[model samples]
Target: MQIDLQNSTLSSASLQKSQEARKILESRSGSGHDFLGWLQLPEEQSARVQEYLKIAADLQKLDAVVMVGIGGSYLGFKCLYESLKPAVGTPAGPEILFAGHSLDGDYHRQLLEYLEDRDFGVVVISKSGTTTEPAIAFRLLWSLLEKKHGKDAAKRVCAITDGKKGTLRQSADDLGFHSAIIADDVGGRFSVLSPVGLIPAAIAGIDIYSLLQGAMEMCDHLRNDKSDENPAVQYSAYRNGLYEEGRKIEILVYYQHAFQYLAEWWKQLFGESEGKDGRGIFPASAGFTTDLHSLGQWIQDSERTIFQTILDVEDAKSPVLQNQKNDGDGLNYLAGKTVHDVNRVALQATRQAHADGGVPSLRMKIPTIEEFQMGRLFYFFEYACGVSAYALGVNPFDQPGVEAYKKSMFKMLGKPGHA
Candidate 1:
């Protein structure tokens, strides 16, 4: 992976700030430092790979597996599954479905109906098991599983939550379900490298070992290399520099459709980590060639308060040739070119055009969308988000503001203590 910042100019102060922030992160002395468990996960969790693989093998015997969670629990695994799944054919493992991310009645109703006939497993993720959405979804799904499979239902469910105690943990023990732990130091947004994300990805047939290896390598690199050359440091410095210059919004641009959920995961990571204390750059995402038609005009002509960071995949893997034809479709001006060639040109052209329109940008070149590179990508952003948020003088791990709505909702529902 390579980060090109030709269009982004970082000041010396910003660079120095990034260095300090890296120190703070490395020393584990920063605010919310208790949540720094993710820094060691790549190495620490490596030992559990075989265990997760064995569990995945069991789950794959089913027709499908439903992953139930919200926020970090849902996004990280979904991002990996969607981005790495085969583009055109069925996945090698069981089909993976998602729930507990929303409260839509129609969607859950249809999901239940769809699952009525298929043999499936459930992986419910929640540290507290009291997060309204997933709790409700899991209750309904578990009831259905019991009604459908009787005493065997417990064998088809896995619970990932606090190891020692939690509602989910107690349920897992009482029901004799397979279980995994969410360590005390890892927050939801940062729990991807843990079993929270890896288990589901493994169940879906992703290369979990390579993924962890990539993150491990990145972790080692960041620890040893503390210079400006470090991608995480440079990324943090550049974005923070832009933020200091009144660029209050950061747009993460990707040319491929598979990266949509990856962007969503990123948004939540940065938005929750940094968007506090009346600070933080608003995180936004756009897909190229697709959003160019709709949002391009605004990005081009509107206020220059947004900076872009583009995720550029250097290769499109399987290339499709634009076969030469003579149907007078623009006179076949260009023929025998691969579709990726056109996409590459579009990426370059858009970057140049946007830069010319006063949008300073940074480009992160990903070698390919394989598991190793994706692991590196995930760690890169996560580490950078930590440094960046610290530089912004905010806690990178806690999302205190997130409780406001939950409190209001619980009160409205007259949920005992809240009422």
Candidate 2:
């Protein structure tokens, strides 16, 4: 209910210094880049989105839309779509799907099963066209398409790949599929604004313009309006200060299972941005009350090696429970207690106790974890990550470290998993 940030962990001194960061933010507001890299639109960067929308209209006639990329591929678009659960005009219209991970056969069979009577469209994404999971999955699906729709089946597909040329690009061209190129300079994790993300979002009927507007506004807030009032500087100061205070392991705890995606999104943002050359918070996630079973022991009684950022929602929009009915056992104390209410109270109590004790909890209680909320979270984390990188003198946009595994994986004969 408060427009002001409700639960902040910043001390007075740290909050005060955020004013300097705000000044730096004001200078770069909308004055900086539109899109991140070289695949500029005919006019402005947003013009490309309009073009993608036209393409999406045709592609949406299909029943399901499958994307074939990983990391940023799945995190940004999947997080937004699943969180929003956006309304669609038709169940037969385009919906978001992924097919670029795991070697398991059941899911592959299930995908085929789902497409039994459905006319499917796909967007296969790979900047290099060489990411293993995506490549193998896309190839398998490409074969399926040929079986179903014939050699020109690529007409029903869209390929988001390298700009000038790549294996995917050439394949798409040869097969006559429409194409959207990933920008040269923007890395996959940071390519959400690029066609890498927008194309699938467009297909899914998401208000990507609104999503980008939120990003643009947050960018403006980070650059031109980031006073101590701004969340970006405030969160960064609190988090980095905690790191300086030896709270190195940050467990991002969320209660609602749906909001769990925020954990992965946060991990990639903080982990990729700050974890350079042996530095940064070790980002981890907990679906609270649930993780209280597994991670709670270590957090509560183990070595004092952790802190928490609990992502709480003001309310779960839908909650079902029985009234104060009389049963055999006298359960009066818990009779009227809805699980949602109990969960919130428990989380609040946990926050208070952690703060009262030596361990500090950064309670980022979101107003709601809906589309706009997710949009807000994405912007907040992105700007905060930028500030963290700026503070540490690293480029937030590039991810050389993330690419290291691909290099090593190509050298190996087969999949050697990651935990």
Candidate 3:
């Protein structure tokens, strides 16, 4: 992946700030540094490939597998699974469904009903098994598994949770469910490259090895190349520089529908990491042409506090549009342009128009959307997020603000410890 910051600004100070942030990150001396396990995840997880592969292979025997988790657990794997799913048919492995990301009863009800007829398995992800959403989903799903497969249900369940202690770990031991460990240092938002994200991706038949290899390669690149040319450094510097200039919102724009969830994951990563200490750029996203009609007017003429980072996929695999020759609506000016051809032009046009309208933008181009490129993309943003948040003078690894809502919910629900 390549990042073009020509349309964006990067002051020397911000560039220096990025380099300093990198040093702090590399030295493991920054705030919340214990969570820097993500820095080594690609190499570390790559060594354990065979173990996850075996787990995936076992789960693949079922018709479907429900992945249960919220936040980082759900978003990272969900981003990869949705972006890489086969366009034309079922995955090479079992159908992978998701749960525990929300509290909608209707959705879980439908999910259970869907699984009732199919031979299914479960992979529940949580550090503490008592987290309200996934705990509820897991309880419901485990019950269904037990009802359908009886004592053998243990064979179909896998828990990825705290390594030493958690309600989930105890339950896994007691029930004899296949299990994996989430290292103590890795935070949920950064756990995508860890077993928390990879197990589900592996079960969905994604090339997790290639994904890790791509991430590892990117990691090495950023470590060796400390110059402004480094994509991660450049991205962090540019966005931080813009934030200083009153551009307080960063909108990640992509043309393909596949990147929609990726934008969501990016939001959680940056928002939760930096949106503290009364500072941080607001992260937003838009799917072009689709959202253009709805959000274009505002972005074009709204407050000048927003900038954009456009994700440009240079070679997205897409079908060519066939010509409609009847001319009833209009004459066919083009006969065989690919859909990507039209989308690329739209990207260029929108970028130019937005720039003309006073919105500075950055363009990040990847050759195509595939496992290897996606791995690189994930690591790129993650590494940059660390630098970006630290440069903003906040702890990038903790989400103390997130507990505010949970505290309220627990008290309202009359949970035992809340009062």
Ranking the candidates on lDDT from highest down gives 1, 3, 2
Tell me the deviation in Å of residue 306 in model 3: 0.5
Clashes per prediction? 0, 3, 0
Q: Highest TM-score, which number? A: 1
Compare candidates 2 and 3 on TM-score and give the better one: 3
Among all windows of 10 consecutive residues in model 1, the one with the lowest summed lDDT is: 325-334
- For each candidate, what TM-score against the reference? 0.98, 0.82, 0.97
Please say which candidate is ahead in TM-score: 1 or 2. Answer: 1
Question: What residue runs in model 1 are displaced by over 4 Å at the alpha carbon?
Answer: 320-327
| Candidate 1 displacement at residue 295 in angstroms | 0.6
Question: Compared with the true structure, what per-residue lDDT tens digits does model 1 show for residues 1-419?
Answer: 88898887889999999999999999999999989999999999999999999888889999989999999999999999889987788877788998999999999999999999999999999999989999999999999999999999999999999999889999999999999999999999999999999999999889999999999999999888978998898999999999999999999999988999999999999999999999999999999989999999999989999999999998876555554555566724456667787898999999999999999999999989989988998898899999999999999999999999999999999999997
Q: What is the descending TM-score order?
A: 1, 3, 2
Show the lowest summed lDDT stretch of 10 residues, model 2. Answer: 34-43
Residue 51's C-alpha lDDT in candidate 1?
Answer: 93
- TM-score of candidate 3 relative to the true fold: 0.97
